[model samples]
Target: MRILLHICCAPCSLTVVRTLQDMGHEVTGLYYNPNIHPVGEYLRRRDTLRQFQEQMGIKVLYKDNEYDPQIYFKEIAFREANRCFHCYRIRLERTLFIAKRGRFDAYTTSLLYSKFQKHDVIADLGRDLAGGGQVGFFYHDFREGWKEGIEQSKAMGMYRQDYCGCLYSDFERRKKLLSE
Candidate 1:
């Protein structure tokens, strides 16, 4: 299957892309994370993903116009408490749209690689987006290789972010630290 993998960042992409390749899927990366907040963090993730693409010899599609944080903010407007669903919705929707456009056999997301992210939410969103339509959603429990991705990314000297990449998430992360 030719897969269009939605990459959240370089570190997370490590295992997912490898796993997809190992499964005999031709993988192309799609970098479209409008949910990532703060321009600098977003740019850092994008740049690191670019480097990962170069080193891993994978083709990555960048949608700079969709990188606007405002799109994310608007998506979650007045619904900050359940922002994860909305965030995943926007990303997976975009990925499926691009998957159809690019004629990919299936689409998956590096978001599944993160222990911090809600797997059920992401999987449901992906399935809902695909809807047995022109494109298919590849669902895998990528968290199994979370440690491997961390170790390899560390070896590669990639910038691993502590937060989940949104202003609310940043605040929540800081809150946990302050409470601790």
Candidate 2:
């Protein structure tokens, strides 16, 4: 099946790309993460993805939007409890739109590969997006490949980020360190 893969970063995309290809699926990667803070970090992530796509011979559809923290904060607003729901909504919504326009047989995301991310929430958003757009959400728990994915990316000398690419995550990470 032809699939539109929402690639969050190069390291996460590595396993997803290889796995989907092995399954005989035509994959096109989409990169859109406005949540990543600090323009330099965003650029680093984007460049890493570009390098990976070129080296791996993958077709990438990159949307270089401005890094607007307001979009992320506005979504969370006073309801920090449902921050992830909003985040998933934004990202998957964009993926669904791309999948519909690109005429992909289905769509999935590298976010599924994150052990830290709320996969169920992402899955729910993906399903809703697909349903609303009449597209299929290929729900693969790519977290199964997390260790191997990270190891392979490290072996390939790819930059590994410690944070989850959001200002809130960054603050939380530091807070955890301080408490520890």
Candidate 3:
């Protein structure tokens, strides 16, 4: 099957990409994270993904020239308590649309590879968004390979980010650090 993988960052994509390829699926990637705060951090992830694509020989479509965090904030406005839902929704919604537009057999996200991510939430959202089966939602529990992904990414010298990318997450991370 031709699958479009939503890549949040290069580190997360390591295991996700290998698993898809090993299963003999033709994989293409999409980097559409507007949730990443501070343009510098966003660029670092994007550049690392570019390097990964070249090394892994996967075709990845970048909407980097179209990065806009304000749109992201607006999408999650007044829904701070439910920010994760909105964050995952926006990125996955775009991936779903792009998959339909590109005529892909299915779509999945590397977000599933993050140990910190809400896996069940993302899976449920993906399934719900796959409505009418216009394009399939391929759900894989990529967290199983979390250790391997981290090891491989570090071995490959990828930039590993600490936070989940949203401003709220960043604040929470700093708050935890201050408490420590």
* TM-score result, candidate 1: 0.94
Least accurate stretch of 10 residues (summed lDDT) in model 3?
168-177
Model 2 segments more than 4 A misplaced: 176-180
Candidate 1, residues 1-180: lDDT per residue as tens digits? 999998989999999989888988899998998988788899999999887787876999999877888889898999988988999888888889889998988999999999888998898889888887978899999999989989999999999998888998888878967988
Q: Write the per-residue lDDT of candidate 2 for residues 36-98, one digit (tens) a residue.
A: 887688889999998879776689988886457677778778988787788878878888888
* Model 2 score (lDDT): 0.86
Pairwise lDDT winner, candidates 1 and 3: 3
Stronger candidate by lDDT (1 vs 2):
1
- Candidates sorted by TM-score, descending order? 3, 1, 2
CA lDDT of 27 in candidate 3? 96
C-alpha lDDT (0 to 100) for residue 149 of candidate 3: 88
Root-mean-square deviation (CA) per prediction:
1.6, 1.8, 1.4
- Which number leads on lDDT? 3
lDDT of 3 by residue, 39-139 (tens): 89899999999977978879999998769998799999998999999999999999999999999999999999998989999999999999878799999
